[model samples]
Target: MNSRLPENELDELPREIIDFAKHIAALPDEFQDDMETAYNRVVDSVRRRRRILGLVQEALAQLRLDIKYLMFDLEMTRRERDELREQLGD
Candidate 1:
């Protein structure tokens, strides 16, 4: 799909962070510690984001399942109603 979401989906960290990580190792020695700190922050943020996203995905999946089951039951009820009416010649 032509979407921005499926690209990194370990819960959607900003592209800039990934870019920074890719280049952090190339920074001068004096800046490496700061870069390391920033990279660690990005990792933590990504982890939290993934947890939240996982919960949301699970909830949505459950809602879809429930909707499907309810629809199936409603259809069955309608069929039963129709059969009973036919038997009663109504």
Candidate 2:
């Protein structure tokens, strides 16, 4: 049987996964069923893990930006408080 994956699906998959799938496909017909099932499970797990990792990376970036904004606001507030104290003393 032809073992090549579709072009669109190949793009996101890592080389190792592709190679593993090709190896599985090379197995004898008697083992194809079990091997293909296991391969599908592995691919699904990898995709899920990748998606979670991407979400975490995105959240981390947003958190960093939020921290920068908060720092700026805190500095401004402190400066305003100092100015108010000086004016009162005068």
**Of the candidates shown, which would achieve the greatest lDDT relative to the real structure?**
2
Off by over 4 Å in 1: 1-19, 81-90
Q: How far is candidate 2 from the true structure (C-alpha RMSD, Å)?
A: 1.7
Which pairs clash in model 1?
Answer: none
Candidate 2 stretches with Cα past 4 Å from truth are: 1-4
lDDT (0 to 1) per candidate = 0.75, 0.85
Tens digits of per-residue lDDT, candidate 2, 1-90, equal 224557776777888988888887789989988988888888789889989999999999999999999999999999999999999999
Compare the candidates by TM-score and give the number of the best one.
Answer: 2
**Model 1 reaches what TM-score against the true structure?**
0.58
- The C-alpha TM-scores of every prediction are 0.58, 0.90
Model 1, 9-74: lDDT tens per residue?
623567676666657767787887897887777778887987999999999999999999999999
